[model samples]
Target: MVEIKFNGQRYAYWQQVHISASVDDLAASVTLAVTRPGTGQRLGVDANTVIEVLIEGTVVTTIRPDSIRRHVDANSHSIDIEARSLGRELIDCQYSQTLSGLSLDEIVKRLCSTFNVPVQVTAKAAVVPDFSLQCESPANALINAARAANLLLYATPDGGLLLTEPSSAAPVATLVYGEHIESYTVVDEYKLRYSDYLVKGYDYRNDLALKGAVKDSGITFFRPLHIMADKTGQGVGGCDRRATTERNRRQARANRIDLEVVGWTHAGGVWDINSQVRVIIPDEDIDGVYLIGDRAFTLDDQRGSMTRLSVMKREAFLGDPAPGKAKRGAKHKAKSQDERLIYATDLE
Candidate 1:
């Protein structure tokens, strides 16, 4: 979640070292190289503006522009720069177990037990939606390939990800990613993104109480239930630049998963960005969102990218996040729970 969205900028963080090393280790720092496409106007960075750096799910340290240091040679090809750690702590993780079942929340509590957490648990639930099939692995796998790293860890016991120690808890300090949908209160309407004012992003590092602590995966963009935008200002907005177009232009790509631009809420209102966003793959006989079952699609907000699979069938997920049947008499006490918790957090 700690990204440097600057124009033609190359930065190396001297703060926050999340790598394995020892007093006997020779290297003094860990670094990251970042480069942009050179066109947009970058504003959040400055020569004196110092930002925090997070390494391997850990916040190592913060360094100044001078201390971090930077050099731009005659080569225009260096799209990425490296951010190295200074006098940071050696990073290590231990496996802990909890009979209550572990999750991100438990992880942070154990890590920062000494501090009073500044995080506003907008809401917490030991339960995750059953997801009849399973929380999609291809989805998280797609993300792993999409974003250079597994920035958002998938923890649904899908046999895909490495679950944290047995401590039986979710992330205590995390950069959650998710949409902030707000037009409707239905499950299908859950794409509420920060751009729609349906989602809220917070930078917990600014709060002394939450410093160096994994606030909550709720802030991180994941399923319709979890979020962590509040911890790292990683809220995804509506105005994000989509890459599917470029990705589509390439050779013989079809089948598997489909991608499309359906509709989006905009300016003082809601509207569709494209008139006809059909699911289609090229060359192969298959077309029209055939790969991802014509249902899964990602929002533009960088912070919230993991769009957890909806229990609703592909056809049900067609139009939008709006629910179909009236649930008052159908099944679980969903209506009452929605009324109770939606107001507390995800609800706009």
Candidate 2:
């Protein structure tokens, strides 16, 4: 069940509502359709009206209408409302500053306070000195700072912000393909693969000279792809760390196989973005742990309720050496076998 509240009144006359939330740097949004008020009716609302969305008795989001449309015909009249989470305010609020010797958590907290947005930081990141940035908005600054620390910042269901390390929590539930999954689709992309990473930084002590390459290796084939990265403001150790982190990220994304599944269980209330989940699929020979990267919650009187999940490998969330390898042995073997067969045939 869904409820919309406006002007100190609760409304349950909505025909349908859809809520989408994701961990992939997207703002949670709500779309609802309600019966239009009749002539001389006291109910009044507009695009600027602040509203709250309640799902199954829990306050899911606080938003203001981004757009409102009215549908009128001989048969009926209805109003469609679209709203975005309060986090959108951060994006709209521009900021400019330079701070030295502040950690990622401190920066996020300060920014959130400035914008009057509540924040919760689950994990702390390494502190850096002499950080400087100029962004058009506070959101952009926070995002870039989080990226440097390998963290993620997103809006929570209750209109608060969350800054945390992905895949740091344990799985809340296990999903079996034949049991809870109603339908699913898988996508595997590997066209952009790299085996070596070269990260260059500046040596401040040596009169701002460009530092040498910091290399890291990963699994690859076909001409040993090389990737270059600039860590201009970072130190030598920071550059090395950045190279390793980027290499792990690239390798994980290159060999990534994502799954989109519609399941029977109610995952919205139980799981959030970056939540770990154990998945088993016998037919696809897949049995591993994954992270919930994206999710959509839907409920209707006729169709019942369902949750759609975008599951990605742990590497996508935790980078590398944390969850180790995902289920890619079979696919790798098949590709290698095909290559060997082609070479043998040519020789014969």
> lDDT for every model?
0.22, 0.59
Per-residue accuracy of model 1 over 74-165 as CA lDDT, tens digit each:
54222322332221111111222221233233432332232221111222213211111122222221121111111122211111122121
Candidate 1 lDDT (Cα, 0 to 1): 0.22
Strongest candidate by TM-score: 2
lDDT of 2 at 120: 89
Find the candidate with the highest lDDT and give its number: 2
TM-score of each model, in listed order: 0.21, 0.74
lDDT of 2 by residue, 130-210 (tens): 444454556655654454456678878666689887775678777887687766776544444444554433333332322
Deviation from native of the Cα of residue 181 in model 1, angstroms = 25
